[model samples]
Target: RKQLVYSSCRAESAGKALADVMPDETVHNILLTASLCMGFSAFSYEFMPTGDARRFNYIAMAMTGFCTIGYVSMYNGVGVIEVRGHDVFWMRYLDWAVSTETFLLGLAMLSGADRWDTIFILAMDAIGVLCALVGALIPAVVAPAYLLGAVVFAAYNYRLFGTMQVSADRMGAAVSAKYKRLTTQSMAAWCVYPVVYLFCEMTRALDETTEVALYACCDVIAKCVCCFLLLSQP
Candidate 1:
């Protein structure tokens, strides 16, 4: 009887955690989510010391970051419940963030590219998104699509980093250092996203409770934490 009662309580607690948007937030996380998105967007275009040559690129990247909260919210966004608790796991769908970001990020990286670079990046993005969206539509292709995206991403970042070198030269030493830091952090965060997607959305061994918890943690790391890191750079 005691074991049964304990199990039932755990189930209830998990359910409540998924259902509530607030548990113990210092500030409502949804609002914080929005704020971070907007904050990063504003800083990227307005305040950051980036040159005008990459202005369009900055806009594309900023928009990608701004819109990514949609995916985060869909997965399991959090909010403050009271002073002592927090709410999470309100939704699900790990691929949304990854798929969408792949396309936009490619374009953002493509900004200021010459014809050949532009064509290559666009072609790869189209294929990558096709795989991801088709998998999303069919559910059967999701896992394979993620694997394919990893391959494309390796190429994408390689070429993009090469192009960024030109921009880095134009931006100068102090500002270029900041750009390098931001790129490194952003790319590192992106790597975490796919791992979460695989575990939470692809594999079936983990239960919904554990999957959602992992998704929640990784989502914050990839989105919010990266945003602050970008802001902190001089």
Candidate 2:
């Protein structure tokens, strides 16, 4: 369904002037797919009562959708160790997507977290994202920065996940249970992302196909399943 939406939207945009002038226009397809998903999640929000977790879930969907748009160019693990593909793969405005979504998710989780807790998560994720972004854009020259960002991201990502678990305990029963499931499961599922990134970039153990597949699995579990779980809450 996601691919279908991406393809259709990509096709429609192919004839427009931007498509004609821009290089490798198909990469923009992710934005279309994400927008469609965001709209669907927004529409689905109406099914839940006012002020439910579904509202935040809808925002998460949008965040996931929009943030993934930056893929300067996807690296398939089969071959090529060129430097161009690594750093700052934000041709499609990845900086915007990641930074915004990090902010959005931290903000949304505030429904269940204390101000200090939420701010801490936001600060770490923001710093991590910025560092990671810088690292991604310039892996060769500023590899240390990227590595540091990855450390910040990997270390703090788990911390932020734990915060969600703690927050879940304090919320009302319905919200608590859902947040618990969402946070715990999301943390575990995403365990594969960092590993995939590191091994793919370093050892080349997995082909690009496997790398993408792992990422897709993580996304479906983290975003899609979590959204539905939130929708089903109460």
Find the candidate with the highest TM-score and give its number. 2
Model 1 misses residue 233 by how many Å? 0.8
**Residue 83 error, candidate 1, Å:** 37
The window of 10 residues in a row where model 1 has the poorest summed lDDT is 79-88
Candidate 2, residues 118-181, lDDT tens digits: the string is 6665666667556544554555634575466567666655655576556666677766666656
lDDT of residue 58 for candidate 2: 50
lDDT string for model 1 (101-126, tens) is 54334334424346676666556656
Question: Which residue pairs come into collision in candidate 2?
Answer: 77-208, 87-136, 87-137, 88-136, 88-137
**Whole-model lDDT per candidate:** 0.52, 0.51
Q: Candidate 1's error at 183, in angstroms?
A: 1.1
RMSD of each: 10.2, 9.9
Question: Which regions of candidate 1 fall more than 4 Å away from where they truly are?
Answer: 1-130, 136-139
How well does candidate 2 match the true structure, expressed as C-alpha RMSD?
9.9
Q: What is the TM-score of each candidate against the true structure?
A: 0.53, 0.59
